[model samples]
Target chain A: GIQVEQSPPDLILQEGANSTLRCNFSDSVNNLQWFHQNPWGQLINLFYIPSGTKQNGRLSATTVATERYSLLYISSSQTTDSGVYFCAVIPFQGGSEKLVFGKGMKLTVNP
Target chain B: DAGVTQSPTHLIKTRGQHVTLRCSPISGHKSVSWYQQVLGQGPQFIFQYYEKEERGRGNFPDRFSARQFPNYSSELNVNALLLGDSALYLCASSLSVGTDTQYFGPGTRLTVL
Candidate 1:
């Protein structure tokens, strides 16, 4: 079994500020994804970066598989960005392909 | 083009009762997985089904079971539920098994009394 740990379990920022969230896994992974859980409990896909870096609009993510960590960055955050962010990964195990998740980081963006 | 969809947004049942939750994957997706998320914690994997066959299972007990249909939809059943079973059940779907990005649906909130 692999372990996923997220940093800065709680964060608060003013609207238009920037923030970064980090996730560290205990084992090698074949797939990694970031999600934004809205107040309604919907897990919205943010990025699917197993390695390397990717960006979508004001959001970007970089994963260093060799280092077993990843980072998600949000710039010029909006009040609507207030929610929980999660990082999930599929470890390179024998026959299982389950996505293990980190405890998550709660972000509050005040307008 | 639609994302994963789940049925019965919320449910409440007494201990020892049985419950079933349904999920429909995105069009053309062939893998579906189930997870349970307790309050203030991350989601835990329960089961993974691909092309109507069980591919992987988590640390949950036999009380939890799931099956996939020919159409790639899925249903998760919990038997003789306990108070600890109360949590948010999530359904995720991907284009295929291994290494694919899994998109999740709005989870079903279950409360066992």
Candidate 2:
């Protein structure tokens, strides 16, 4: 089984500010994804990066498999970005491929 | 195409009662998985089904069970619910059982009283 740890459990940022979140996994993972859980409880997929770097508008993520860590960066953050960001990994343990989620980083972007 | 869908956005149950939750995965997806999200915590894996077979089970009690249908839809059954079982149940559909990305449903809020 793989253990995932997300840093900066709580983050508060002013609108238009920038922040970065980090995730570290205990073992090699076959898959990694970032999700944003909105205030309304809707889970939205942000990125599916197993390795390398990817950018989607104001948000971008980079996963370094060898380092067993991933980083998510938010640029010019908006109030709407206030929510929990989850980092999930699948280590393919027992051939299940079940995703193990970290507690997540709670971000509050105040306007 | 439609994303994953779940039935009965919310539910209320009492101790010693049995309840069934349903999920419809996104079109063209073949893997369905369930997770439980307690308040202020991340979702924990429950069960995963691929190709109508049980692929994985979480650390949940034996009272919790689930099965996948022929059409890739799935149902989760919890028998003799306990108050601690109250939480949000989320269903996710993946393009495959291994490394594909997973999309989740809005989830069903279950309140076990």
Candidate 3:
């Protein structure tokens, strides 16, 4: 089994500030995804970066598969960003394609 | 296009009771996976079904089971539920079985008494 660990389990920032979340896994992965869990418990897809870097609006993510880690960056955050951010990966082991998720990082953006 | 959809947004049950949760995947998607997330914890994988067949299962007990239908819809059943079973059950669907992005539903909040 693979292990996923997220850093800075709890984060609080001002509405206009920027932040970065990190995720480290114990094994090689074939797929990696970042999600924003809203207060209503909806897992909103943020990015699907197995490797390399990608950006969407004020959010961007970079994954260094060789290093078994990934980073998610939020620029000029908003109040709506107050929620839990999760990183999940599908390890390249066995025949199973199940995603092993990190404990998640709780982000609080105060206006 | 509609994303993954789950039924009974919330549920309450007693210990030893049996419960079933339903999910319909996005159109053209043939893989459905189930995950359980406890309070203050990350979501844990339960089962993965592809093409109406069981492809992968997590470390959950035998009380947890799931099946996918011909239409790619899925049902997750838990027998003799325990208090520990109370959590948010999420259903995710991907276009294929391996190395694809999984889109999740809003999830069903289950409470066991």
- Model 3, B12-108: lDDT tens digits are 9999999999999999999999999999999999999999999999999999989999999999999999999999999999999779999999999
**lDDT winner, 1 or 2:** 1
TM-score of 2: 0.98
Q: Given the true complex, what DockQ would model 2 score?
A: 0.79
Q: A1-111 in candidate 2: lDDT tens per residue?
A: 789999999999999999999999999888999999987566899999989999999999999999999999999999999999999999945585789999999999999
lDDT tens digits, residues A1-111, model 3? 899999889999999999999999999999999999999999999999999999999999999999999999999999999999999999987696998899999999998
What CA RMSD would candidate 3 show? 0.7
- Candidate scoring better on DockQ of 2 and 3: 3
* Prediction 2 global C-alpha lDDT: 0.94
Q: Flag regions of model 2 displaced more than 4 Å.
A: A92-94
DockQ of candidate 1 is 0.90
DockQ, cand. 3: 0.89
Error of 3 at A86 (Å): 0.6
Instruction: Name the best candidate (by DockQ).
Output: 1
Segments in model 3 whose C-alpha atoms lie over 4 Å from true places: none
Report the lDDT of model 2 for residue A14.
97
Q: Taking the candidates one at a time, how many backbone clashes does each contain?
A: 0, 0, 0
